[model samples]
Every structure is written in structure tokens, then in C-alpha cells.
Target: MSTFEFKKNIHLIKILNLKATNINELIEGLKKIPLNSVYYHTHRFLKQHQSISPEPPNDFAYWIEKALNMKKLSEIVASVNIVEFNKLWELKNKYIEVIKKNTIPYERKKKCNKNEEFVFMGCKTFIIPTGDTASNLPEFYEKLKIIESSSIYFHIFESRLRIDSQINDFQLWLNENSYSAVAEEIGKIDPYNMTVENLRRKILNIIEKHL
Candidate 1:
């Protein structure tokens, strides 16, 4: 196994709030943040789609590396054949090991900016500063403009249902974490009837008020 490789679980996205300055610290931070999706909808997606996934191991590598810019680690995972694994845990262990080995020291890269706008599932949110200030209101609303123009709220969920369940799992995760209120607001939207723009507005509205 390469030293730069570690076992990966998309569930890590649920822990994105953990502060880390480097890959090594991020791994440690993840260890402390309990996983919210280990036995959640992930199982359903795997059981229904593994045999049909379009090169799942490679696809998995692509997204993880894209999120973190960890090329070597993705390369290692990209080489595996999912068909050979008898169980998900086996593959999961392989990913975990990749993270374990990926500890070479480097400048800490914050995976997300609390102040910078976060666009996920085509909805927008930001790191709401603790206190209100006249200066922040304008900048915060500007983030809303970006979301109003573009949002992917339902697209990822509907699309990834074929290959991955993380999209749905992430929504469930938000409900359980700090975004519980926002998640509740999202839950009330009727995906069957709403347009992408409508869902985007609902999510952004929640985030705008809270967030």
C-alpha cells in the first residue's frame, strides 16, 4: 500500500466542518467527528448499483481527489476493481488505509471557507458570523445572488442515485448536524413538484436566515 493512501468513506463529507491545516490533521479531525452515514443509505446504493456502476472505483477516486486535490491517493483507489470485493468493508478498509498513509507534511489547505460561499447540491450557504454587522449583510446577500442564478439541488440526488448515495446521505447528515434547521426547511420542499430553481430558493432562504 502506498504511504499516501488511506481508507476513504464519502461519509467524511459530514465532517467537513472540522478545522485542519494539513492532510495529517484532517485525518485526525475526521477520527474525532463521528460518522453520520456509515450504515445509512450508503448500503442501499451499493446493493442496487455496484454491478451497474460505470467504473465505480475510478469514479470514487475522481470525486475524492477532486474535493481534496489528492491525486496520488485517488490514483491508488482508481486502480481497484469493485467486482473483486466480497463485501463493502473490504473496499472501505482499502480506502481508509490510503488516508492513513497520506500524511506527508504540506501546507494546511482549508477544505472549505466558512466565510466563502458553499454551493452544494446546487443550493448555497455560508458561514454565518456569530454576530450581525452592517458590513456582512451585503456580502451575505451577494452569495444569495450566486445561488439564485445557479443551483443543482435536485440534480445530484437524482443522478447519483444510480452510482452513489452520498448525495442523499449528505442531506440526512445536514439534518443531524448544525444545519438541522436548514435541513428541516429543505425537507419540506416537494422534489416531485419543484423546479431546480424553486428548490434552490428554498435552500438559500433557509441558509440566509440561519447558516
Candidate 2:
């Protein structure tokens, strides 16, 4: 990722900021920023760092992170609506479906137009999408701009849903742990003498942590 270049051209900047103008002016303004700066800023703004998961033996998390990072990278490349980059958009849509399906023992294998597999992932495989390496970077970047500024809000909603899903998973784990502990305590009690007040407190504590 590159650094964000601060522009000295106030008029160009104003034009870029104007919603009434065509995006060409904004693209021109963005070009003034160094390539490295633009790359770095785009990555940072898109929250690329949070994409990675530290968990081992579940490299899907890591792969998903990288795929999302690549999406961000692609957005930077196309600088227009990502849908304008048909291949990238299609790949991204498929990847999202794969994630949402959460299927077991599934794999994603990428085949070229000639039917040659360029990237393949098994049940535990981690594969990053790669294609169109020879495409113009500036054009890609333009498509990314459109994606970043898209008004449809699907991406934003998807991100929020992912967060909610994580929270739910954590809650389920806590419940499982709490139930195990409660079972242990019940085993020590006399017939019909078990109390749930202690378990309730533990459950409350878990809920509080999430809140």
C-alpha cells in the first residue's frame, strides 16, 4: 500500500469534491497523489488490517481476509463501479456466496478461459484470486473509486452482518462453556437440589461482555 498524496492544486481538489462534475476530474486529482500513497490510503480506508484472522488450522479466515484485501486492491484498480470490472465483480460475488454458504468440504478452483486451473482451494485450502495482471492499473483504480463511493450499500450491510455473525458465534461459545460448568456443579448436588442462580450470573456476565 502506498501513502496518500496531499494535493496542492486547490482548484483540482475542489473539482474532485464537486458532486456535479464528472469523475474524470477526480481521477485526475487522484493521479496527482503518488501511486504508493494512493495504494496505502485506499487500503487503510477500506480497513484492510481487520480482514485477517489469527486462528490456525482454519486458513479460510486468512484467505477470506486476503480476498477482501484484494477486492479493495481491485477497487483501487478499476476506479469505477466494480461492476464495471466484470471479471472482478463476478469473482467477488461468487466468493461472497461461498462465504455465506459456509459449506463443509467445499473448494473453489479457478479455471482460465482455456479451462486450465490457475488457483484451486480444497476444504482447508487458502487461495487468493489473481487475474488480469496485464490490465492497466490506472483503469483499475478508477473502477475502485466507483466501488468505494457506491450508494447501493450492499458492501456496508455485508460487513455489518459479518460483525453480527461473529458476535453470535462468541455468544454460542460462551453458552456452551457455561452449560458445561453448570453440568459439573449439578453432578455434585443432591437429587432435585440444583440451583440455576449461579449459572444465570455467569450468563449475564457473558452478555455484558458482548454489550
Candidate 3:
């Protein structure tokens, strides 16, 4: 497999270790990663691994299990008890059983190639890369990416980056995830033809419709 197969962190350099006493703590603990880091990873992931359309992703639990090299933890997560329980702490308890000592920490890597994108399991925050044309105009893009309250914000960010990258990431992600119909409804925007503000408006508009 290529090095690209694994998602790497590049935007933010702060490495955080998480140990949760409660669901609230867990939520806050995960938030330390910062918006820039979160955006970086989400964009990079979408760019590097595009499928045809979007769907629910099996997020952090599985990634952490793999990154930490915890086979047992992964096996438990794969089981369907998650279907029966509906509480955050209920789910947290299962994970805590494995990492009570907090030994499995992954470093937030610094300085990935501009050609390379960030990946997350993941973190909170939206990050614009130095190379993103929109990022050049922080006055506009910052307001767009900072995003006060919206799950679709990330979706917008991912779509924006996918369109901006001018690469095959989104296509692969869509195909891999089996989200074919959604792509047909969406028109492509060439990053080359777009100005920073135009790009921002384009993605924000696209995400808004979905939200």
C-alpha cells in the first residue's frame, strides 16, 4: 500500500491525549484538536479518498482502534451493541475499558507536503491550507470555514476542498462509498476558473442545500 493509504495530520501541530471521565469531558477532550486541524483532515480525506457520493462514515472508534493497534478494541466496536444503547457514556464505557491508562496516543504530525492533505478520525475545527486559494483571503474564507454551528459545514468544507483540489479524491471517495446518485445532481466547479470568494460561495451554497 502507498503511504497515502493512511491519513496523516499536517495542519496543526498540537498533539492531544484523551481520557474521559464522562461524555461531556470526552466531547470537550476531543475538541482540543482545533478547527484548522479538523478542516485539514476532512479536506485531505475527501480529496485523497473520494467516492461517488456521501454517506455515514464509521468514524473515530475504528480509526483509534487501528492507530493504537488494539485488536480487541476493534472487535468490540465491530459488534452491534451500539445499536441497542443510545447514550454517549454507554458507548464511552466500552472504549474506556481498553484505554483507561491512556497509553495509546497518536502524534499530530507537522508539515506534510503541500501536495499531501490532512486526515482525521478526528478533530474539531476548520483549517485552510497555505495553498488553498480561498485561504489567501482570510477576510472571506475564514468566516466561511470557521462555521459557528452546522454539521453540514464539514460536508461543505469537504466538498469545497474536493472541488478545489482538482484531483481524484472526491471521485474515489464517492465510488468507494457507493454514493453515485448524489454526484449526478452536483455540478463540478473547476478550481482553476474560480476566484477565492467565488469558490467559498460555491461550496457554501452547495452545503447549504444539503443542510
Ranking by lDDT: 1, 3, 2
lDDT of each: 0.40, 0.27, 0.37
Worst 10 residues of 2 by lDDT: 6-15
TM-score of 1: 0.29
**lDDT value for model 2:** 0.27
RMSD of each: 18.2, 23.8, 16.3
What is the C-alpha lDDT profile of model 2 across 1-211, one tens digit per residue? 2222111100011112211111222233333433222222222222222235322212222322344332432333333222222232243443334333442222222111332211222111122222212122243233323322211121221222323332222122323544334333322332111122332334334333433
Q: Who is ahead in lDDT, 2 or 3? A: 3
What is the C-alpha local distance difference test score of candidate 3? 0.37
Who is ahead in TM-score, 1 or 2?
1
Candidate with the greatest lDDT versus the true structure: 1
Candidate achieving the largest TM-score: 1
Please, what are the lDDT tens digits per residue for candidate 3 over residues 1-211? 1111212122333444544333233344545544433334223333323344432223344444434444554454444233233333444454444334433333222222333222323344344433222211222234455433222233334434434432233234443444333333333654323333454467556544544
List candidate 3 stretches off by more than 4 Å: 1-28, 50-62, 67-184, 187-211
**Candidate 1 lDDT for residue 204:** 62
Per-residue CA lDDT of candidate 1, range 1-211, in tens?
1111111123223323444434455445444433222222123233223244433333334444655666776677565543344344455555556656653545234353343222111112222222211123334334434532212432223332323443343245454455566556655554423344555567667668864
TM-score of 2: 0.16
**Which residue runs does candidate 2 get wrong by more than 4 Å?**
1-21, 45-211
